[model samples]
Target: MANISMTETVLQCHPMSEKGFVDAIAVHVDRAEGGRLQIKYTLHGLVDGIDFPEVAQPKRTDELWKDTCFELFCGRADDRSYVEFNFAPSGQWAAYAFTGYREGMTELACAPPQIKCTAGEGIFEMTVTVDLPESLRALDVMAGFSAVIADKHGRTAYWALAHPPGKADFHHKDCFALQLEARSAA
Candidate 1:
């Protein structure tokens, strides 16, 4: 393959529930050749109070979604299949594959994701890069980026691209906010 050309997308996810804890959440996604994707999240709000889970060993762990974490969903537009990646500030990650909406979920065999995190007075930023699984490497793909934030008082909020009418379902088709096209070789 030729040198991969990268494209960046910036997305602002609105809170699906409580909105008071956050002023804004920005998600940036960059895709390049060979299905390498990088996602960055910046949160501005009362960051100090939130509970960010930390693992003793800083390894991949399930249920990162329960606390403050960033998420990414990617799949072929028509396949009804996708992989969900979760990143936590505590240097933990999780990857899961699904056949359909909330169905046939299984742990995805993926290499460890590269994650970096930093925090300021009222801001927090995190970035993660992962290689898409062979099954999801396609000429075109759809993506949904989201987050779950927990406040100091243990109140949780959901943020997503386009929330479903009834609830916050990032896996829902409506939430696939971005489409990525394969880059041509130079």
Candidate 2:
């Protein structure tokens, strides 16, 4: 078995009625073998209980419409970090990587794949833009893009993607940029 370690940085935007912005940075270390992947992430700048489950829950509101809207927009409460993807060993990629968020509610706005690795440079950079609905914005939606890099022999060299605490105003039709770098296991 081979071990590949990576450093990741993430930025995200949280649109809250009360808190105008919630942005943060996260560092990640990942391990992959036999088509299965495991990741451990540490986040900085997160407010108390800002994970998905806590954010997705509904609060009591005087207005009935407000309460109902929250339920419809945000799904079940979840607290884990949504930052891992597993590619099938058959070499087929999933239409979407991660699951848990509402379907069609969040989408990959822009992802341009630039696959070029220079000699002695283990970094391959790609950019992906995630567009999230207003309700899902509080999930810090920008950290959902991640991929595993494999060599010609189908060995995972590294896993890379941007972490959360992304730029604010992510819902303003602006594109969020993500960079991925793959280093050799030499």
Best by lDDT: 1
lDDT of 2 by residue, 1-186 (tens): 454434365433232222311233243423222212122333222223232211222222122221101000112134222222212212111122224332233232322211111111222122221222223333323333222222233222111232234432211212223322222233
Candidate lDDT scores, in order, read 0.79, 0.25
Which residue segments of model 1 deviate by more than 4 Å?
Answer: 1-16
Best by TM-score: 1
Candidate 1, residues 40-151, lDDT tens digits: the string is 8888888888787764565779998888888888888878888898888888889999999889999999888888888899998898888888776646788888888888
Give me candidate 1's TM-score against the actual structure.
Answer: 0.89
**Residue-level lDDT for 15 in candidate 2:** 29
Clashes of 2: 11
Backbone clash count for every predicted candidate, in the order shown: 0, 11
Residue 61 lDDT in candidate 1: 94
